[model samples]
Target: MDEHGLVSREFTHRYVLPEDTLPRSVSSTLSPDGVLTITAPKKPSPSAPNERIVPIAVQGGPTPLPVQHEP
Candidate 1:
């Protein structure tokens, strides 16, 4: 619970890839309410044999800013 009397929840999802599956990169954006919109790169690369897309949601409070990364 928070000062505003709101309960927080956390969830995580994982993906298992086949021999040909791999990860390329990850990207994310933050909403005004503090929700993060995450996107996994689908483009295939020599390093990434399998590609996966995932979106994570946090239900507690807002962060100061969103973090982003590129391959």
Candidate 2:
């Protein structure tokens, strides 16, 4: 009674959990179904200069400039 057919002790009690002797700057908090998300780490922006340009026959090679003819 497994394979998404449920009944493996009710999918291992809805999802096992009981291991993590903590100790590594310990810090945890998740209420999920009750809403409570937190994530941080973002601060680094200073290096600009890229006008973008790539048109060498659609980048399939050949094009040092020279393919113009307008009459």
Candidate 3:
């Protein structure tokens, strides 16, 4: 900071990660040029591989509702 104003503010900051949203595995690497890289492994699917989709279609028109007259 100077008489004019701040030339540049700090780019670094702290953050919090919720436990429920965290991945199983995480990796990080720092390059020689000051570049930081972070990666998280994808979680396994909840559904089984042999799972099948069952379509249940109800063939019927909308139920008629009693009409109400309003002034």
Stretches > 4 Å off in candidate 2: 1-32, 48-71
Per-residue lDDT of model 3, residues 1-71, tens digit only: 78898565456765454443445466779797768787765555578888989998886898689999998
For model 3 the local lDDT of residue 61 reads 92
Pairs with backbone N, CA or C atoms under 3 Å apart (clashes), candidate 3: none
Listed per candidate, the RMSD to the true structure in angstroms reads: 22.9, 14.3, 11.2
**lDDT by residue for model 2 over 2-70, one digit each (tens)?**
788875332222322324332333343659455444333233444468655667545666758987999
TM-score of the candidate numbered 1?
0.28
- TM-score, one value per model: 0.28, 0.18, 0.36
Candidate 1, residues 1-71, lDDT tens digits: the string is 88999977787877564444335555569797989786664545555557567789877986768767886
Worst 10 residues of 3 by lDDT: 15-24
Model 1 spans with C-alpha error above 4 angstroms: 3-7, 16-24, 44-71
Pairing residues by index, what is the TM-score of model 2?
0.18
